[model samples]
Target chain A: MNKGLLIVLSGPSGVGKGTVCSVLRKKMPDLVYSVSATTRSPRQGEIDGVNYFFKTREQFQEMMACDALLEHAEYVGNCYGTPRDFVERTLAGGQDVILEIEVQGALKVKEKFPEGVFIFLVPPSLDELKQRITGRGTETQDTINHRMTVAEEEMNLLSHYDYAVVNDEIEAACHRIESIITAEHCKASKYLAELGELPAAIEKA
Target chain B: MNKGLLIVLSGPSGVGKGTVCSVLRKKMPDLVYSVSATTRSPRQGEIDGVNYFFKTREQFQEMMACDALLEHAEYVGNCYGTPRDFVERTLAGGQDVILEIEVQGALKVKEKFPEGVFIFLVPPSLDELKQRITGRGTETQDTINHRMTVAEEEMNLLSHYDYAVVNDEIEAACHRIESIITAEHCKASKYLAELGELPAAIEKA
Candidate 1:
């Protein structure tokens, strides 16, 4: 059986990445969403294993030391990482695995697995992204402005990724992501080595 | 607006390409089957432009002289070729064009338009291909054997093509082809370029 592909999705805050991922998960049931292992305590209603693999700081540090994590980073003094074993097991079962990580973690994952498909999602316009951040009403104006500036820096790295989807509309963005997954399977490099062996086998037989 | 993609199909005889192309055309109306131009006289009920752009030997030679033909070859003293003008016009109109041509013509078209997706349709197995060819009972045993030999040669050239679809089941083959076309549109080369100008445009306004 063909192993499932690894797909990494990264985008700036307020780009509707979560909404797109939700719709995509509903459409593709077999998809495996990689839940991060975090040292931070779970908030209300957050399941331990289902929401995250809530680990102790020592446990997280040990995993990082042993190279057990595909990617890990400390954010605001809390450690978050993707467990490599779970991802490998899911991919071995011929089911696609989606990693929703930040730009830094995404790049780290790609360095380890060069074949992983990296997708960068973008808002339709910078103004629109600002409007979205402000509309949330949770962040102060200063915080929103800071995120908008950070988003511009992230957009500069868009050219480094494999493909970019404009998260202007939820359905359309999901469709583009689905199409990207389908298309990556059609790559010649994936089958060329197998095809090369066929001719030799035929000749030997 | 983004122009439609062009796809070229090539395979040895008895590979079930005709059935695959027929099903694909019905499934994708946006896919336009390119009609070839020929120096051979039209058979009864064959319409001009629809069936073929019937041309005299001199006219065909003139097209070759002016580089009007994308690809051309002579078989049994009759000439057949694809006109570049008609294909470009169709693609410019936002319709995906498919050329069901032989391997030689397919290669030529690839050289002229490197972006054109080339698909090679193969049988499930060499033995299966021979069985289908012999089952037809329209050709002599010697002819069937010769075709099987030719099929092997074509398989050797499979690496030169972009994708290979095994025609074990008609519907399955069509689905693979459709998936390939859908996927090609999501190529990093194509999608990333669109993102390039968007950021600059958004920042300017």
Candidate 2:
């Protein structure tokens, strides 16, 4: 069996990565959602292994020192990271793994797995992104302003990704990502190395 | 408006390039079919400048001498070439162009337009390709053997293409091409160069 694809979906903050990921996983049940390890305490109803591999700061630091994480970052006084072993095992089993993460982690993953498909999701517009952040009605003006600056910086990171998908609507974004997946499968860059011969691919076709 | 995409579809002889192209065009009305200039005589019901830009041997040679053709190849004592000017004009107008040609000519086009999206259409298998050629009922045994050799050589040229699509069934093949088009538009490689800013693309989204 072919080793499964590693799809990293990430974008700027407040760009709806989480929402898109949940809907996408529902539509594509075969794509395994990678669980991360975090030092933050789990919220109510969150399972230990299902939602995250919750750990103490010392344990998280140990995992990092052991190079057990694919990518990690500190956020709001807590460290979050993707466990590298799980992703490798799932892919080795010919099941695709999707990591819904932030820009920094996604870029870090790229450094390790250059072959992984990196998709940078963007909000429809900067103004709209501001509106979404502002519409939340919880963030102060300073927070919103700070987010806009971060969003611009994240968008500039678009050059590092393989594809940029605008999260304008849920279904449309999902469909475009689905198409990107299909296109990547058909990419000659990978096909030539994978099949090694036309007869085999033709026969399988 | 963004410039249109130039899609080159090529494969070994009798792999259904013409058949698949016709079906794909029907499904995608916006894709412009590129007309080739050929030294071959017009067959019954074939119109000059439509089916092909019928050209005399002298005129075809003159066009080649002037480097007016994107790519040209001779077969069965006749020359066929794509008119570069027409394709250029169409794409400059933001209309996508589709070129259905043999492998050699497609490779030549790549020399001038390295950015062109090259798709290699393959039959399901070597046996199936052979069956399709034989099913045509027009080749001598020597010709069949010769074509098989050429097909193998052509498949080897697949390393030059961006995609390898199997012509298993016409509809499935067309749908795959359609997905490729959608996927190409969303490609980050082109997006970074085309849009230049996330705000622009996001707003459009």
Q: What DockQ does each prediction reach against the true complex?
A: 0.42, 0.54
Chain B TM-score, candidates in order: 0.83, 0.90
TM-score of each: 0.85, 0.89
- State each model's CA lDDT, in order: 0.81, 0.87
Candidate 1 regions exceeding 4 Å error are A39-46, A55-59, A74-79, A200-205, B38-48, B51-59, B74-79, B135-140, B195-198
Kindly give the stretch of ten consecutive residues in candidate 1 chain B with the minimal lDDT sum.
B192-201
Q: Candidate 1, TM-score vs. the true structure? A: 0.85
True contacts kept of each: 0.36, 0.76
Summed backbone clashes in each candidate are 0, 2
Superposed Cα deviation of residue B191, candidate 2 (Å): 1.7
Model 2 lDDT tens row, B7-103: 9999999899988998999999999999889888886777997778999999999999998999999864678899999899999998899999889
- Local accuracy of candidate 1 as per-residue lDDT tens digits, A85-198: 999999888889998877778888988988899998877778888888898776777888787877777777776788878788898888888877766665656565545586
Q: Which stretches of model 2 miss by more than 4 angstroms?
A: A40-56, A137-142, A197-205, B41-51, B197-205
Chain A TM-score of prediction number 1: 0.85
Q: How does the DockQ of candidate 1 come out? A: 0.42
